[model samples]
Target: MAATSRPKLLAGRKVLLLADFQFEDLELMYPKMRLEEEGAEVSVMGAHPAGIKYTGKYGYPVKSDLCVDNMSTTDAVASYDALLIPGGFAPDYMRRNQAMLDLTVAMADAGRVVASICHGPWMLCSARRTDGSPLAKGIRATCFSACKDDLINAGAQRWWTASSCRAGGPFITARTPADLTPFLHAIIDEMAK
Candidate 1:
């Protein structure tokens, strides 16, 4: 049999993985590698610029290539094709940063792909529409069970706690680390479409 030819499905695409200290290791690393495997340029952006390192919940360390502060300019956040928000205590901290919240809100308003998992929805809950409505309003989403009330209170139309993943509009969300595969596959499927 002849070897099969594979397409670089994400060729030329740019993805930004947002996180900070205490981010879930698997959720962050897996998607980063898989996105790269599909030929996308993946950059990790944090609260600080390049050279600042953040430790994951499990002690994994990743350096940020860009900071949310630098993303104040339109081009900084608008240039990316998608944004990936991994779960953990990181989202708790990330949501408190005005710049981070602005970036998330900008990406959502732009209708860009935003893939988040587990506690990742925390950041989503913190985002708001230009009209000042919660961004999660009427959006189908899934996240860690602990976040269900927060999601609903923030206005998620349907938040699935037991499901592996849910994709609605430009948002793709998953419940936990175990759901990472389908979570990312859902994202790849979205990008392909």
Candidate 2:
């Protein structure tokens, strides 16, 4: 007898996830596995030393498959179909890495889906366009309340939605872990495009 197979809506899609210490575990894991389940290739990259495990804010530890120290932003942007930034205090540390910032912008410019949740939008606030403007400028999205001002200062408008917000272009965002399921759905929808 033949078995049924789930539809691979995201087949051939590649998603790049940025990670660091204190990342929101659910925000990272949900998307990673969901995307994979839908047939997308997901790669985890972190700023920590190669092979070291980074702990999330809730004490969940996940090892990164790639180290940011040796990462090539250009190669990364060209290689992936989308980029994801998981929220937590990890964005506090990720925002300090120039390569991660560059890759975030490049991916957006390349017409790839760029999704962020909770405090993850912090990384987006730090990214810049080729013309030196803020990447988040003019994007309409919702994020954790604490990061609201940063996004506003970056020229983004507030979107008061409980679920994940999927704006046109390469932007998708959510407010917190409670929005994870919807956020994952948004990413899949965007990549399927």
Q: Which pairs of residues have clashing backbones in candidate 2?
A: none
The residue-by-residue lDDT of candidate 2 on 132-151, one tens digit each, is: 78888888878898998898
Count of backbone collisions in candidate 1: 0
CA RMSD of each candidate after superposition: 1.7, 1.8
| CA lDDT, every model vs. true structure | 0.87, 0.85
Instruction: Kindly list the per-residue Cα lDDT of model 1 for residues 1-193, writing each as its tens digit.
Output: 9988799899988898997999999999999999999999999999877779889999999889988887663775558888899999999999999888888888877778989999999888898767888778888999999989889999897648547899988899999999988998998888877
Shift of residue 18 alpha carbon in model 1, Å: 0.4
Which portions of model 1 show Cα errors greater than 4 Å? 1-5
Candidate 2 C-alpha error for residue 182, in Å:
1.7
Weakest lDDT window of 10 consecutive positions for candidate 1: 70-79
Could you tell me how far off, in angstroms, the CA of residue 11 lies in candidate 2 after the best superposition? 1.9
